[model samples]
Target: MAEFTSQGGILRGQDVVSILFPVAVIPLLFLLRSVFFYVKARSQFPGPPIRNFWVGNLDQTMANDVHEKWLQWNREYGPIFQTWNSPFSRVIYIGDPHIITEITTLNWPKSSAQYAGFRPLSGDALFVQTNHEKWRIQSKRLAPAFQPHVIQAQRPCLAKHLSNFVRAMDVVAEQNTVVDLSSLHILLTLDFVGDIAFGTNLHAISQGRDCRILQLFEIILPELMKCGLFPLRGRFPILQKTRLMYRAIAELRSMAEKAIKDARQKGDEALGTSPRKKISDILATQREPDESYTFSSKELCDNYIAFLVAGGDPTAHTMSFLIYQVLCHPLVLKKVRAEIDANIPFDTTVPSISQVNLPYLNMVIKETLRYSSPGFGTFRVCPVDTTIAGVTLPANTTLALWNPAVHRDPKLWDNADEFDPERWQSGQPKVRGSYFPFSSGPRSCIGQGLAMLEMTMTLATVFRRYDLSLESGFQMEYLPSFTLKPKNGLLVRAILRKF
Candidate 1:
């Protein structure tokens, strides 16, 4: 016993270190393994510094000025840029249109679905799901609902709503107040989509804030963003067990289910005296495209919720920022206002979103999308071994690409960085392969037509009624997210036109 104690307990310093060193080395070993894979993969592409090790360069990109910064990267490194996931992971940034168009159109090796765990059940249902066959079928079936013929019918409704929007704006204008043009734009969009989706008229334009349901929607959606970014949580039992996260998800789910139930009753009330029926409300009642559990009413709920987001916020951001641009370029604003006055004539009334199909207004809307794109940092997982730009890519690689980076390529635009509406003035609508605001191909945004219509009408109506100028010295910039948003509010003074 004495010998055992002396030998075991009083072991030599070298022996003690030998035993302790391995334990110390274990964590380092694990870290090294992760780093090795990350570094090796990242070497194949071009990228910026990792910057902050905790979050990599993503923080810089995530800042309010991310759009400009990312575009700066494109200027710094031509088209393809390399990105790292902070201390680990590899990302490829592709901004060239030739490459973008080719990648989006190809029947290719498999593409990543990105819809892991609850993502498939979330607002990401249509875009995130990887199943090509199902996507083909579902998209085809759903296409009819958004066709020009059907969408045109809704234009009258949209026009009427825009009239309310103008009245609300005029009230703000009449007081000579520095209006929160940005917030108001969002309110208008929320009420518009709500009218169409759940038949809820929060009257956001008039009330100037969301209703209880909209507030709940905002709460639920911010939580939904958490799942969208990290879609694996539902399967990883521990993450699923996290009460706060799960509870928030539960709340969102409950809210969505309630919205669906409420949707059934909304159509009657929404037909004008109410906010009026949107195409989505009609779709919600009719047959679903697919009978699969994946596309059921529950799925419809998720898709509609997603649709509201995709439809509303981005367009709001676009219109608001475009207004900011109008402030910066008075000449452009004057041109637009003049066009509106000439075509749409101000009276005791205003034209609908469809009435102002002016050439220059179209250019402004298109340019706004190009300059400050709605979505940024879009990610897709590689489904199979594929080749991009002649470089072989292994299966299961996550790729994050930005449109602003590519759209700003000088090669794509003569003065890519400049805000020139003249590029689209001819009414020819010619776009280089690399200039995609609505992401290209079969997987492109489904609600693009609606968004375009919304922008055109909003621009036409507002410019027709009011001439906008910044509130004495406010310079605004872009806020980066999955989409580009405006930082600080768009505060502009509007002068009403009297016929």
Candidate 2:
């Protein structure tokens, strides 16, 4: 009996060892791998000291002032430096315009690690798609909808929405109320994009409130930032607010599905009859004789969401920043208003795309894109070992084209920190990689033409009618999210201009 009991005890001890051994060994291996990479990265490039071995500099990278931090690091460690997102993930930031030009010109693959967060919202859409062939096909098919002519045709539609927006503000001005300008920009852009992309009047501007879809986006974007920087959060439910994200995603997809159904029904009635095609019409229509390129119902929904994700927020944020900058600098505001008054009629006449030609206005737009870039940066990866600017990076290494740093680099600009529209007054060719707010290369933003038109017309219409002043005692702060936005929203008093 005693011998039998001893044998059972020995077996239980062996079972415990079998389970614990791999657990101990796996972490040890991970630690060694992290150490090896750390040593290798340190030898090759200069970077800030590692604050934590486990999370690395991820906390700082995710902070609200991350752009400023990158600028500081650029000054201290040179234009090119390395940082670890986590113990296992390595990132290299390139702020040197020459190096950035070289990398973008080559058209290297986008970094999956950086864009994985978008997959939850965008799926295999062009913005988040990593496959070159798939991206090419998608880009080709969608290019027509954003052609200059096509976007120009939508000018009337844009102007209609802007008229509603201005009227909404006119009421605010009459009340002598301080309003959150950022929220108003969000509503205006949402309504315009909703009309163009989904063929539905969200009435976000006319109704003077955000729709359910917009509210869902607000929830989804922050979660995307979390998943984007820390990829594991995307894969594992426990690591993120999966329930909230999934619910929002489900609702958005459901809305997209309904839009697709409506578009299909409308197309059946107007088959080969309509000349002008909305974005939804283009997305929903099947590719004749080339069924392979035709989007599945799911793909249609995903791409629909992609258009919403890309179109609305970034442009709105850019406008908000432009307003903030103009308001802060009274001289810039005077110059912009004077230019507007001199060229555009003071009546409620929204100018056509070709007619809205204010040189100083264009300069202000350029300077705003540079000084307060809405996009944080773009990411890329090399398929093989590559050397850029004297540093050799291994295969699949994530590289960031740090736009904020590049735009503010002293080597690239004069008085880089100042908001000077005059910097562009010379009309000289820009330093190639120094001012890519829409990014560069084949993967650049396709909707940039539309965004520019919207901005020009909106600015002209708004400043022509109203003189805006920043709320007293209001200081600007940025929100910590995928894009740079005002933390507390842009508060201003809109005073109706007297002719």
Best by lDDT: 2
What candidate 1 gets wrong by more than 4 Å, as runs, is: 1-36, 51-55, 86-88, 107-124, 213-253, 265-277, 288-295, 352-354, 427-431
Q: Clashes in model 2: which pairs?
A: none
Q: Which predicted model would earn the best TM-score? A: 2
lDDT of 1 by residue, 1-499 (tens): 1222363366666776788999999999998998887777667666777767766665554355656767788888767776554554445677766556666777332234234533633544566556777667767766766887666667766766777888778787899888888887878788777766655565777666535544554444433443334443344536433344456556656766776777655543554454323676656555535732324666677767667677887888889878887778878888887787778755625565446678888888888888777765355555677776676665676555568777677876778878888787565445455666776676778888888887887777777667677888788866554356666879888887666
The residue-level lDDT of candidate 2 at 429 comes to 69
Native RMSD of candidate 1 (Å): 5.8
On the 0 to 100 scale, the lDDT of residue 427 in model 1 is 55
Q: What TM-score quantifies how close candidate 2 is to the native fold?
A: 0.91
Query: Each prediction's TM-score against the native?
Result: 0.81, 0.91
Each candidate: what lDDT? Answer: 0.67, 0.82
Q: Over the full model, what C-alpha lDDT does candidate 2 score relative to the true structure?
A: 0.82
lDDT of 2 by residue, 201-286 (tens): 88887565447877888878877877787777777868446558867988888888888888877877887887755767776775
